[model samples]
Target: MADGHHWNIVKIPPIVQELAAGVHEPPSQYMVGEKDRPAIAGSDMPEPIPVVDLSRLFASNGYGNDMVVSEKQILNWCDRDVLREYTVRCREITSLVLKKLAKLLGLSEGYLVDMFDEKAMTYARFNYYPRCPRPDNVFGLKPHSDASVITIVAIDDSVSGLQLLRQGVWYDVPIVPNALLINVGDGIEIMSNGLFKGPGHRVVTNAESERVSLAMFYTLDPEKELEPVPELVDDEKRPRQYVKVKTKDYVTGLFETLARGTRVIDTVKISDNLNEIVS
Candidate 1:
C-alpha cells in the first residue's frame, strides 16, 4: 500500500459495508470538519492514497484500499495473503482465549472451543473518525455491547475516544499505543451462565486528531443455537440464566434491540442476574 501507484475501485467494486443498518444516509456518524487525517499505520506515508480509496475510507469501509473485502468475503486482491494470515492468527488467538476462559470457569479446556465450528463467521469492522472541530457535538459510536462471542479492537492511532460504562458513570479507556482491547460479548455471557458480562462502551469524538479503530468480530455458524451451557447450569444454584436461541435469530434481534437503544443481552436472560452489566 506504500507504493505511489493507485488502484481503481470501479473495476473490482470494493465492499461498501455499513457499520450501522437502516440509518444509511452518508454515515454522518463518522464525519468531522475537513482537516489533516493522521497516519493510521504508525509513521511515514511514502505516497498519496488515491481519491477513490480515500473516499471509500471516509464512506464507511474504504480505508485507502478496501479491496481486501467484499460482501462475498473474498475479493481478488493481490495482497490476499495478508487477510488470510490475519484470519488464521485471529482464530488461533481467539481459540486459545476461549480455552483459557473455559478453564477459568472450571470447565474442560476444549469445552467452549467445541461450540464454534469450522464454518463459523468472522468479520472485520473499521471505524474512522476525522479530526472534529466540535468534539462535544458528535459521537463516533454509541454505548452498545458486541453481539459476537468476542470482539478484539486494534487501536491503530493515538487519538482517544473509546470509553466504557462502569457502575453508573462513563470512563475513558486509556490508550496503550498499538494495544488490543479484548471485550467480552453477549454470547460469552450466555455460554457462561451469566458468570461473564458483556461491557457497554461508546466512542466520543476527539478534537485533536483523526483516529481509526479496527474491530474483529468472531461468531458461531448462523444456524448454531446458543444457550447457557449444560455444564454451567445445574439444578442447584446456577440455573438456566439465558434463553436458547439460534445465532441468526439472536443476531437479528440484536440489531433490532440496538436500534431501539436497549441491550439485547437483557432480553435473552431468563433470570435477573447482572442487570448492572450494560445500562
Candidate 2:
C-alpha cells in the first residue's frame, strides 16, 4: 500500500547490453573482482550464491522483497490443532499480561483476569487483504480501537499493512521478528481513568502483494458492567472520565458507531464542566 503520500511512475531503459542483443561473453563488472579471474557460476550449485542488483530492485513498484507466492491453500482440516493450540497459547499470554497490568494499576493481581475466569468472551479474527492496483482508494480496515480489553496481532512479515495515527500522521507498522503487536483497548483506557491510551489504527492494502494479519481480542464476560476502577476517581485530582456501561452494550454500540465511521469513545468521554479531563 501507499505510504502517507502518493507516487507517480517513471520509465527507464535497461542495461547497456542485452545478452541476446550481442555482447557475447560476460562483462568485466560481472566478475567478482580482480582477485577472482574467473568466477565459477552456472550449472548445478553446491552452495548458495550471492547476487546483488540495485537498479532493477529500486525501479520496481511497491516493496522489492523478491519472494514467490504460494499457488495453493497450504493449511487444511489437518491443521485444526495448529489453530486451536495457537489461540490457547495466545490466551495464556494475554492472561499473564492482564494480571501484571492489574497489579501495575494498583488493583489486585486478579482484578482484570478475574472477569474472564467465569466466562470469557475472547475471540479472534483472521484477515486477508488482496493486492490492489489503487491502494490509496481502499483500506483493509478503518481506524478503530478494539472493543475488547486488549488485542494481540501478528502480521505477515513479507508485507506491511497496519498503520497507527500519531500526532495527525499515519505511520506504517514495521514487522519486528519474534514479536507480536499489542493494542490497548478502550476498556483499558476507561478502567485506568485515562492513564492508558487506546490508539486509532487501520490497515492499508499492499499494491504489489497480498497481506494477512491475525488479531485476538480478549474480552470480559458479556454481562459484566464495565467502568473505571473506583480507586482511580476522586473529587478533585481525578473525576470520572467515561460513562459507566455494560460490556455487551458497549460492544454493540461500538459496532453501530463504527458502521457510521465514528468513534464511540467520544460519546462516552466527558466534556467540559465536571466531566472534563483532569489537568
Candidate 3:
C-alpha cells in the first residue's frame, strides 16, 4: 500500500513514460510568465521541452477547480485519470517528508506541516528533455536553487542528467528506480535560520537518450512574510541571517534575476551588525 512515507512503485500509476512519449511540442501553456518560457541560446537545446503542471490534480472540486491554474493549460498535457492517481501518492509523500524534517529540527511533528495551510501553494512540474546530437555542447537545465521550502524530484530511471555542485566540484546524481530526491530550498534556509543550505544543481543532456523528471515544489502563501524561525535564532550566537520579505516579492525577484548558479538568497541576506566595537 502506498503510504505517507513509502510508495509502492508497482502499484502507483506509470504516467511519466506515457506523458514523456506523448509530448512533441513545447509546453508554452504552462509557463508561469514570459520569463518562465524556456529559451535556448545558440543551439543550446535542439529538441522540444514540455512542462506539465499537476498542482490542480488534487483540488477540492476536482481538477481545474483551482483559480491560480487554467483548466486548458493543465488538460493540454495531463490526463485527468492519470494525474488523479499521481497527485494522491505525491501528497502523501510530501506530508511524511515534512514530518520527518520537523523531527530532525527538534520541532513538533506538525510544526512544519502547519506552516502550509490552505493558503500555501504547491507546484508540480514535469520536464522532458529530448535527445541531443552534441549533448556536450548544450545544457539540459541550468544550475539554480529552488525558491520553495522543499522540492521533491522523481528522476528518469533509465537516463541520467542531473548533477549537483558541491565544494567547487560537480557530481552526477545517479538514476535510481523508484527513488525520490528531496532538496532544501531558499525558504527552508530562511526558516531554519541557515541551518540548511539549498545546494545548486543543474541537468545535462544525453547524446543518445531522452530524460524526464517530475519536480514538486512546496511554498508558503505568497502574501505571507517570511523570516527565520524565532526559536532557531539566538541574539548573540546564531543571529538572524536573512531579512524578512514577502514570499511573492522573493519569487518575483528570483525570476527577474534568474541565472545559472545565481544565489537569489544573497540579495535578502542580513548584513553583519556594526554596532559592536572591535578591538
Candidate 4:
C-alpha cells in the first residue's frame, strides 16, 4: 500500500515553480478584494491558468524525444529540458499507478493502458490562488468531478485547503510535503462500471497565504469507445451501469453539462432494470 508519506521525495521541479510564479492571471471570483473587477466567464478569466500540453511535445510518430511548446511566452520562460524530464517522469508514474489499479480491479495490467492510445492526452495545469480577504465566503475552486481517467495533484505543502465530498460530508485532504494526491476521474468510473466512484472535490481559500498546485490529468484516446469492462459484468450479478459512448463525446457532454451547473454522468447511467436487461 502506498501512503502519502511515500511520495514526499518527489519534488516539483524548480523551473516549473518559476514558470508558475511568472504566469499571472486576473483574480478569480473567489477572491474577496476583487469586487471592483468585472466578472468574466470562467473560461475567459482575465489571467488564464497556464497549461502545458505534454502530448504536443511528441512528434507524429508519438515517440519523438524532442520537446516543443507553441506558446512563445511559455517557451521563453520554461526550460525545455526540465519540462521534458518532468513530463517523462509523470508519464511513468501514471502508467505504474494504472497498472496497480488494474490489479486491484482484477483486470489485466495492460487493460487500462490499452485504452490510452499513443496519442493519449496528458495536461498539466499550474494553479495559483491569491489570498482572500474573506475566505469564509468564497471558494478557490467550485465543486466538481474530474473528467480524466486519473489526476495527480502536487500542492504547496506549506498551505492546506483541498477538500473532497463523501457521503454528504466534506473532508479536508491533508497536506503532506512532496506528496502527490491521486484522484479517480469520471472515465475510470465508467470503465469500472461504477465500482470506483469519482468523488466531487473543491478547494477553499485562505485569508493569509496564497496557494499553488500543479495537477496532471491523464485521459484516454478521444476516439476510443468507453464502456464497462465485460469481465466485471455478469448477466445476473453485476451489470453494465453506463451506456457505451465515445471518450470524446462523453468529455464534450461533461463540459457542456458543467457549464449548465449539472452532471452529465447520470444522464448516461443505466438504470437498475435497464442495466440488468442490457447485461
Q: Residues 1-279, candidate 2, lDDT per residue (tens digit)? A: 456776788775564323223433334433233432221111232332223232442344765665313566455659669778888877867777777788888889888877786676767787877665445545567667778888988878787677776665566666665567877888888888888778887777555677778888888788887788888887578888888788888888888888776887887787657475332
What's the TM-score of each model vs. the native?
Answer: 0.70, 0.69, 0.70, 0.72
The RMSD (Cα, Å) of candidate 1 is 14.4
* CA shift of 209, model 1, Å: 1.2
- Write one digit per residue (lDDT tens) for candidate 3, span 125-215: 8898876554554567766788888888989999878877677556677655777787888998988888888887778766568888989
Best by lDDT: 4
Candidate 2 weakest ten by summed lDDT = 36-45
Misplaced by over 4 Å in model 2 are 1-78, 274-279
Pick by TM-score: 2 or 4, better one:
4
Over 4 Å off, model 4: 1-73, 276-279
Query: Per-model C-alpha lDDT, please?
Result: 0.71, 0.70, 0.71, 0.73
What TM-score should be assigned to candidate 1?
Answer: 0.70
Q: How many pairs in model 4 have backbone atoms within 3 A of each other, for residues 3 or more apart or on separate chains, i.e. clashes? A: 2
Residue 256 CA error for candidate 1 (Å)?
A: 1.6
Q: Number of clashes in every candidate structure?
A: 2, 1, 0, 2
